[model samples]
Target: MLTDPTMWRPAGEMHRCLTDGGSAFTEIFGTPFFDHFARDAETAAVFHDGMAAMSEPENEPIAEAYDFPPTGTVVDVGGGHGGLLVEVLRRRPGLHGSSATRRTS
Candidate 1:
């Protein structure tokens, strides 16, 4: 099950440390590490590329498991980088879709 950060202190602390430290983390995991990814643009690019390396294979099973409503408009809210929505639209050719930062008044 997923845990909400507001309700869980350890999760929040872990996230903080991941974003904050090098020694406490690098000691356990060793070098060629994420400190650069957190700060450097080139490293971030390489990190994102590494993450994308597995995305297509990782997402194929998920794409097969679900169906999108095909005839009406579908809005994806805060959909991360639009990848999943793009995949859904690709799989469901008849659907009209839009992705928004948020639903607002």
Candidate 2:
């Protein structure tokens, strides 16, 4: 998505987007990025895959740094693949957690 020419157009025309009351992506694609993403399963998968890959390194550190309460629910919003939550719950055995999103085959 970042490599797409249309994605770059938004950077160049950010002021126009700000004044026109639309996102930089909407100005270029005639729709919001999420709208486009929702319509294209392949793109959505790629985006999610990228996010999950990028999040891998961060999850370990986050899980290590935080101190979760012994008996409470931890919620991860947009927790694709549940990597972060899994690590967190793994470290804190008694702390239950829920991921907002689940991986799909």
Cα-based lDDT for every prediction: 0.54, 0.79
lDDT of candidate 1 over 1-105, digit per residue (tens): 123222243444566567876443344434334453445556455544544554656555665687766677667665534566677777888877788743222
* TM-score to native of every candidate shown: 0.44, 0.76
Query: What digit string (tens of lDDT, one per residue) describes model 2 on residues 61-101?
Result: 99999877888899998897789999998899988998776
| Residues forming the 10-long window of minimal summed lDDT in candidate 1 | 1-10
Q: Model 2 — which ten-residue stretch has the worst lDDT?
A: 1-10
Q: Which of the numbered candidates is closest to the native, going by highest lDDT?
A: 2
lDDT score of residue 49 within candidate 2: 79
Off by over 4 Å in 1: 1-39, 72-83, 96-105
